[model samples]
Target: MSTAAKQKAKAAGIRLDDDSMDTPSEPLAPRTAPGQLIGLQGRVHSQQAEIEKLKRALEQRAPGKLPLEKLHEIPGRRRRLTSAEYAELKANLTAYPLAQPITVRERPDGEYDIVAGHNRAAVYRELGRTEIDGIVLDIDDSMVEYAAFFSNLLSPTLSDFEKFWGFKSLQESTGITKEELAKAAGISDSHVGRIMKFDLLPSESKDLLATCPERLGSNAAEQMAKAVAEGREDKVKAAIERLVSDNTFTQAQAVAATKADRAPRDRHEPMVIRRGARKVCQISARNGVVGVSFSGSAADEADQWAEKIRVFIEAELGKQ
Candidate 1:
């Protein structure tokens, strides 16, 4: 294989070394019959042939312009941009030339599959453009999905919910564990765990997030997941719905809404009544009762003030 092919394969986590291409000499199972052994060998040979085909296709090629109609969208390969973001992209493309060419790979059917830049291509089409500058990668079909994933993963605007689904899709595609994914993605395992909390969300919440992924973040998702585990799924779902509908609602407030009981009221400081730096009394309210404690000379006159207060209340009641 060429050095370029080796590099691409390595980036996709595929080993293209001679050792990996060699067929197994020993039977996969000692109890396997001759026919089964032949079948296994045939499968290995087929895989080797496919790898060689991919390597040959990886020969250097310059980027060229391709028609927009020829570029096709592959499901699960591209992240959907929000409507506002799409409009901004369209406006930018209209005012300025494309800064970067999209990447695509040619198919046997004489069409191209988009490996990245789905939004740019879409914007160009919306602008009534006929062709777009594209670099055709000669990678295998299996590697196309991974290419698209990594491309979208690096986007700064990708939301936490979108990232969670991306990680999930990559995991299901590669069958790798969370730890392995963390290492591969160059992120902490704990971060991966936190992102995966989206999986614990109810179907209704997931549906809402699919529409507005930026509504909730990883931290809020973790809190909601804990609430779900504690049998508060309904509250969590309601909170997420409110969050989606109300743009002003924050992730922290959404998590708070999932609590079974209302948050405790803030404590109020006592109000001190003083006479020229002398503490006369302190008035405070706690648990629905008001208390007044007199100090110094005020203690002796407390009964007099109490009688005045009683008389004032009686006069006010008589007016009412």
Candidate 2:
């Protein structure tokens, strides 16, 4: 395997000597030859430190033209903008130019390597503006993944949908995997998995999240992904409405929604199901939708007991 692949293997715990790829035994990260990690680790750490220094400098550099000849396409990067979206952003760039300069590392040949802000760089290309603003650094393309992470955080990046796709793209472009980014973002592996697993989502649905990543999130988008995957467009819309109405449809909630059935009165009525003073289910409403959460063992038996109670109540009501 290549060096980058080896590094990713190490990060992902994919052992190189796995005699059986089909074996279910836990795998190990791919190994490098002896003494390789020492230098590789240091370079990675140093590259990170260098980017930290550039963070402050990045704020002060005014946007301008990038010398076209010196500019290079970002390695492992591509444009995710739709044609219409690209046009709109290009127009904005034409009017105001870049508010911030794209960060790059100097090439051995005296050119520059783009670190962050490919979208803006692409706009510069579209407008035919040469010699744009940049902060030349010393790191190589191997460590450019750091720039992508910081860019995601440093600015009003993608809409939730866009961020999801962008995050996936960055992962693919760079060798950084979802597991690594998820660890950085303080989410679970499954959480990251759900975020990137948007295969069946309609283009419209994907575009919605891409346009509004802030309103949606990794977890929230996952719910929509599941709903679409399950062919429950109507349920997806209702769940989103309920989610928004109750104001509890966070990204985590979105993921959870995809995994289970929803209640009917989670939003409008009191959702208390108790047996012998043990409260089994508790409902919290958001965005006009009610959410019912179960607790303790009573939750395990709630459905059966609820039916019994309903029958008893009907009998009592019939007597009245």
Candidate 3:
């Protein structure tokens, strides 16, 4: 046996040359059942269906389950549709005939669930269109998520006042939390809270409050509410006018006022006592509360009074 012959024999798994080797063994295919094949195919089909659903969601413009029909009236909505809005919708429909299809989900009863397009749907109803262009959505347990409220905070095509008040209506009806509402509306919790407090404002104040929640915090509105409740509607109106006329008495002022039921300040929280231009006493008091004690007239006098209070407080603490 030469080297070549030996190599050939080793490769053959037998002590023989390649030229003398027998046919090689090949791998065999395992038999598969028709039922098993069908099941596997079904799994693949199911996966494809899931992918399509994801794609649809990615392509969707609105959030939540399937959208509602345009023809159906929005249900349980606290905000009434304004005449101006109705007219605007009518005008848009007359001009464009609803180029965008409204989103809707089929209900058990022939009607459909509306997800978005409240305005368009309203227009369609007023137009007497029995059926309109729509995108049917099948919302299985999963809901589409939304970004911020600014997306939904578009002007109502009615009035700016309606926008804020309408937001409150929508939030209450939809059970959306104040924090969530703030996030959606692209505002602070304080801002949302203030806007929601507009109901406490006078008819004259609503416009100003809506335009300036920073100046009309919950507490301040409550103050106005308290005053109005206390048979001081005139005073409340005066306070609101002051707010509108000047950016003073906003936020903390409003909040403080609203919280108390016409309770006089100096009862709770720190209270500030005016000492005129003389050397003063007491502490810094804002939003109806003051701190410390002593007397002062000017800023320098106030500082001296503050120092005296501080010295006395330190002396008392030292004794303790």
Candidate 1, residues 132-190: lDDT per residue as tens digits?
A: 98878766655565556555556677788877876775554444579877865668999
Ranking by TM-score: 1, 2, 3
Which scores better on lDDT, 1 or 2? 1
204-263: candidate 2 lDDT, tens digit per residue: 444444333345665556657767777776656555555444555665665555555656
Candidate 3 has a TM-score of: 0.34
Q: How do the residues 1-320 of candidate 3 rate in per-residue lDDT, one tens digit apiece? A: 43223222332331111122355864443367876566545644443344345435435745333322323543532123446556766787878855555555567786666544666666666666666666656654222111111222443333333444545543433344687667645568876676555566566676554444334445456456666676776666666777657755565554344343555554345445554545444455667545565543355566676677789879999998
Clash count, candidate 1 = 0
Question: After TM-score superposition, what is the CA distance of residue 254 in candidate 3 from its true location, in Å?
Answer: 17
Off by over 4 Å in 2: 1-51, 54-65, 140-142, 159-216, 219-320
Top lDDT model: 1
Query: Looking at candidate 3, what is the lDDT of residue 194?
Result: 63
- Which 10 residues in a row give candidate 1 its minimum summed lDDT? 2-11
What's model 1's TM-score?
A: 0.62
Q: Rank by lDDT, highest first.
A: 1, 2, 3
lDDT of each: 0.75, 0.58, 0.50
